[model samples]
Target: MREVFWQLVRFGITGGLATLLYAIVYWPIATYAQKTWPLANSATWPVAANLLGYLAAMLSGYVMHSKWSFRGHGRRDNLARTGGRFFLVSLVSLGMNTFFVWLLTGPMHGPTWWPLVPIVFFTPLITFGLNRLWVFA
Candidate 1:
C-alpha cells in the first residue's frame, strides 16, 4: 500500500514535468509555425506541433518513468521488451492527444490552447495506467 502510494506520487511528479514540457513545445509551434515556416499550413500546424511535443514528452517520460517512477516495480532485464511496451503506451497517449486536438482545432475551429485541456488532464491518466500495469509490470 505504501509503495503504491509513493509510486503514484513519483509518477505524478514525472508526468507533470512531461506535461509541462509538452505544453512548452506544443504552444509555440502551434501558435507560430505558420508564420515561421513557409510550408507550415495553418490547418496542419496543430498536428505537426502536437507530434513534436509528443515526441519530446515521450522520450522524457520513458526515462523518468523507467528509472524513477516505476523503479524496482517490474522486470528491467529485457530492455527491448520493456522499451517496446513503453513506446506502445506513448503511442496511445499521442493518439488520444491528436484526436482531442483534431476535434477542437479542426471541426470545432477552436484555438490551439483548447486541446491542451484534454491533453494535459485526461491523456496522462490513461497513459499512467498503461505504463504502470503493462509497460513496467
Candidate 2:
C-alpha cells in the first residue's frame, strides 16, 4: 500500500513533467499547422498536435517511469519490449483522446475545451493503470 502510494506520487510528478513537455510541443505546431493545412482547424489541429505530444511524452515518460517512478519493481533492461508495450497502450489512449475531441467539436458542437476535459482528467488515470500494471509490470 505504501509502495503504491509512493508510486502514484512519482507517477504524478513524472506525468506532470510529461504534460509540460506535451504542451510545449503541442501549441506551436498546432498554431502553425492550422494555417498551412486545409483540414487543420483550431479544434482538430490540436488533436494532431496532442498526438505528437503524446508520442514525445511517451518516450520521455518511459525513461523516467522506468528509472525513477517504478524503478524497483519492474525490469527495465528490455527497453524495446517495454517501450513497445507502452506505445501500444498509448496508442489506445491517443485514439480515445482524438475521438472524444472530434465528437465534442464536430458533432456535439461543444466548447473547444470540452474535449480537453476528458483528455486531461480521464486519460491519465487510465494510462497510469496501464503503465503501472501492464507496461511497467
Predicted model with the maximum lDDT? 1
Q: Please, what are the lDDT tens digits per residue for candidate 1 over residues 1-137?
A: 89878988999999999999999999998888889886757989999899999999999988999999999998999999999999999999999999998999999999999999998789878887888889999
Number of the predicted model whose TM-score against the real structure is largest: 1
Which pairs of residues clash in candidate 1, taking residues 3 or more apart in a chain or in different chains?
none
TM-score (all chains, Cα) for each model: 0.95, 0.82
Tens digits of per-residue lDDT for model 2 on 90-123?
A: 7888788778767876689775556667876788
Candidate 2: Cα lDDT at 15: 81
Alpha-carbon runs more than 4 Å astray in model 1? none
After TM-score superposition, what is the CA distance of residue 84 in candidate 2 from its true location, in Å?
A: 1.5
What is the C-alpha local distance difference test score of each model? 0.92, 0.79
lDDT of 1: 0.92
